[model samples]
Target: MTVTDTHTHLYSDAFDDDRKVMIERAIAANVTRFFIPAIDSSYTKAMLQLEADFPNHVHLMTGLHPTSVKENYMEELRHVEELLSKRKFVAIGEIGIDLYWDKNTLEIQQEAFSHQIRLAKQYRLPIVNHCREAFDEIFVVLETEKSDDLFGIFHCFTGDIEQAKRAISFNMKLGIGGVVTFKNGGIDKFLNQIDLEHVVLETDSPYLAPVPYRGKRNESAYIIKVLEKLSELYGLSQEVIAAITTENSKAIFKV
Candidate 1:
């Protein structure tokens, strides 16, 4: 059973002490594919280095994270443009409105999100979105930008059935992670309702680790706990869930 983590920050600082060990642990558990989301230009080198180290496992994405947007955002967007022009990445990602961090920059966040979506369309790559506490805002953008040319995963998705349908309408697969195991994650109530093919597995490592490891640092290996939860939710075996979600990941990332 080959499992895929559609969103993981294997290059994050939290893994500095034992990144290799953590990765090997995940690999041993059959977590074979790793999609790394880009935050900004500063981490580009680290991302590239990670891919060089694990060329077969690590697939890179390029985009400016919404929370990373600020006054110098145009410069950052330029950097994104330059990078896209130069090399290839699996997707344009982790990009969307993050009103939770700073509502003040909402306008710029929207601008950056739209810009990257256009970039993704231009490059004919899928997008990995990072919507947080801004569903309406994201929907507004998607409503206007919806097109056959636009499609991707809504990374770390946490929303209702209606919202899930809305995202799918815009050509997005819901990225399920640790949150689904949470008591109040909400998606659990309606997840089984959505087709498994519309969902993708992710750990968002160094972030939303599944329960049993909740409130603690998350590693890619911990994704098994999430796989178990999903197995239960979908009435499928862990191996089946792994295969289905990994197939879903391949459909979106094309990798």
Candidate 2:
């Protein structure tokens, strides 16, 4: 099974000690494709270095993360624009509203989110969204930008069935990760209700690691735990789940 970790920060400093070993561990576990998301301009060099190190396995995206939007956001957006104009990226993400960190930046976050969505449309690329505690806010922007041209994966989706349907309505595939394995991680309870076609798998590594490793740094290798839980929920084999989700990722990233 060729598993695709649609959202992972392989360039994170958290893996400075053993990034290569960690990635190889994931690849050995069948998690071969790693789509790297941009947080801001500062991480761009590291992301590019990661791609250079693993050209066949790593795909890069350029965008300003909502939390990274601060006083000099215009400058950051300009960096994103410059990157897009210079090179090809699989998508324009992981971009979206994130209110968990700073509620004060909501306005600018919405502006940045909407702007990136337009950039995605302009580039004819899918977007990988990063929403946290701001589903309603995220939806408002998405609603205004709704069109056949707008489509992507809602990275680390942690919403209810209604929200899932709404995201799907906007042509987004829900990105399932370690959260589904938690006993209290609610999404697993109703995940099977959603068609597998509208689902994709991700690790969001160095962040939400799956159960048995929760609270620890997550790595792409741990994605197998997610695949296993999803199998049990959907009454399917791990290989099938991996295959389908990987295909769903391919449909979005087109690589």
Q: In model 2, which range of ten residues has the least summed lDDT?
A: 92-101
Which one wins on TM-score?
A: 2
What's the CA error at residue 5 for candidate 2, in Å?
A: 0.3
Model 1 lDDT, residue 64, Cα: 98
Query: Which window of ten consecutive residues has the lowest lDDT sum in model 1?
Result: 205-214
Clashing pairs in 1: none
Give the whole-model CA lDDT for all candidates, comma-separated.
0.92, 0.95
Cα displacement (angstroms), candidate 1, residue 229, comes to: 0.7
TM-scores, one per candidate: 0.99, 0.99
lDDT of 2: 0.95
